[model samples]
Target: MLLLIAFEAAKSGLWPAISSALFGQRWGDNVVKGSVSALKNGPLCVLLNFPNLALPLMFVGIAAMRRLLGGPLAWAVGLMTAMYFLFAVRYSVSDQFMFFVPFYAMAAILAGLGFVRLSEAGKRRWLGVAAIILLAATPVTYSLLPSITQRFNIAVPGRTDLAYRDSPRYWLVPWKNNEDSAGMFARTAMEQVPPGSIVILDSTTFYAVDMIRRLEFSDKDVRLVILGKDSKMDAIPVGTPNVYLDSAGEGYHEKWMDEFATYDRPAGKALFLVVWKGR
Candidate 1:
C-alpha cells in the first residue's frame, strides 16, 4: 500500500485542476451521488460491461477465496483490480460506460491467472480449454452476428431499434456509427467559416470534431473553442465571425443562442450550427 500512497502523493497537486475540469463546480456532490448509484448497479454494470469475462472472473474469485491463488503477484493483481473498479464506480462522466475498460483489463488479468491454474490441473485441462473457447467465442459472436445481419440486409426478428436500445446488443455491436452524421455536420459547418474563424463546440460536437479534424482537416486553419458550462462569450474577439456547433439536445448552449442571428435549426434532430455575428 506504500506504493499506492506514494503514487497518490506524487500526483496530488494535479487532483484539483483535473477535478475542476472534469466535474465542474459540484464535483464533490456529483461524485458522492455517482458512487452511490454505481454501488447500487455494480452487479448489473459488471455483467453488461464484461459479459464474456463474467464466468472466468467468478472462477478467479473462487480460487482467490479458497487460497488456491497465492503469492505477491496474485495479491498485486487483486489490489490493482479493486482500485480500478473503485475508480470506475466513483467518477461519472460523459460516455460513462467507457470508463469500465480499465477495470475490465484488470479483471481479465485475474481471469487469465485463473485459466492458467485450471490448465495446470492434469485431469481438467480439457475443461479449461473448453472454457477459454466459450469465453472467447461469446464476444466474437455478439460482435459478428449483428454486423453480418446488418450487412446482408437480413431482417432478423426482434432486431428493431427498440430492441437494440434496450438490450446488451447496443454496446456489443459496432454497427451504428452515430458520430458519422455529427462529423459530416461539423465538416459542412467548418466550410462556412473563413480562415482563423473561431468555432465553438459543445461536448458532443467537440468529440466528433476532434476525431474528424485529426483525419481530414489537419491543415485547416481555424480557432477552436470548447463550450463549457462556465464559458464566457465576452472573452471572444469583437467583430470576428464565430460558429457555434451544438450537437447535444441538453440545452447546454441555449442561453447563448439568442446572440446568434443566423442558424440552421434542423427538425427532429439535435444537431445544428449557429453563426455568431460578433459585435
Candidate 2:
C-alpha cells in the first residue's frame, strides 16, 4: 500500500518531498548509493554488533521449535527468520535495525523454548548450555554496559570497544539523526523573510525547513516552494519577495541562480537561506 502511494506520488511529482519527509535526505539524496551499495556494509556491521547474536540464536531456536512447537508457529518463525536475513544482508545501515525488530522478537520466543529444552536436559548439560549463552552475550553486555551505567548515573570506566567507535557502520548514520541547534536554520530562515514572504528552497533543504516551520515555528504566512524538476522559481511572479534556502554551489536552477545574490554559508553546512527582493 505504501509502495503504491509512493508510486502514485512519483507520478504526480510529490515523491521527492514525500521521501524527504519519510526517510530524510540520507536515503533520498543517495538513491544511487542505496541501490548500488545494497549488499555492501550492512552484513559486516550486523556481525560486529551485538544484535548478530540473535541470528545464530534464532537458528538454534528455530531448530528447537521444529520439534516443540506446532507446524504453524514453526512456519511463521521460519518465514520471519528468512525475511530478517534477507533484510540484514541487503542493506547495511544502522536504522535497518528497525526491520530486525519483529525477527528478534520471534527469535526470542525460539530462544526461550530452546532454553527450556536445555533445562530439561541433565544438570551439567544445562549448565554448559547456559555458559555458552552467556558467552554469546558477553560482547553485547560489554558494549551496553557503559551506556547502561551512564543512564543510571553510575560511574564506570569507559569501554573502548563500543560499536560506534569500533565499526565502519558509524559513518552510515543518517543525516537527520545527528544533533542540531533545534530548528535554528528554519527559525533563521523564517526570521529573514517578511511575515508574508514566499520561501523558495532547493529540494535538499526544502522539506526540512518547511517541516520546522510547520511543527516548531508555526509560521502560517510563509509559503514554501520546493525547487526540483517539477517545481521552479518561474512559477513565482518575477518581482515577488522570496528567500532561497539551500547550501551554496548546489547548482540550483539557472533562473533563480543567476538572479539571487549568493549567500555562501560555511563549507559543509546544510542550509543557506538567501533573501531575495527580485530578479
lDDT score at residue 215, model 1, on the 0-100 scale: 76
Residue pairs that clash (backbone atoms under 3 angstroms), model 2: 42-92
Off by over 4 Å in 1: 1-4, 10-30, 35-45, 69-76, 117-126, 144-171, 174-185, 192-198, 207-223, 229-231, 236-243, 254-264, 267-271, 275-279
- Summarize candidate 1's per-residue lDDT along 1-279 as a digit string, tens digits: 335455654667457544443344455555546755455545445665555645565466547633665677667666667666765666555445565676777766666666656656563666666767877787677677656656787544221221013233454454565424555556665555567666667665667666666677778886666776434556653344545445424444545555554555454333345655553
Candidate 2 lDDT by residue in tens digits, 10-97: 7766866455433445553333244434455445334434343445555566777877788887786777566555544444343555
Against the unseen true structure, what C-alpha lDDT does each candidate score?
A: 0.55, 0.53
Worst 10 residues of 1 by lDDT: 157-166
* Model 2 CA deviation exceeding 4 Å by range: 1-36, 44-53, 87-97, 121-185, 188-221, 226-230, 233-243, 246-263, 267-270, 273-279
lDDT of 2 at 183: 53
Per-candidate alpha-carbon RMSD to the true structure: 7.5, 10.7
Between which residue pairs do clashes occur in model 1?
none
Candidate 2 TM-score versus the reference: 0.49
Cand. 1 Cα-lDDT: 0.55
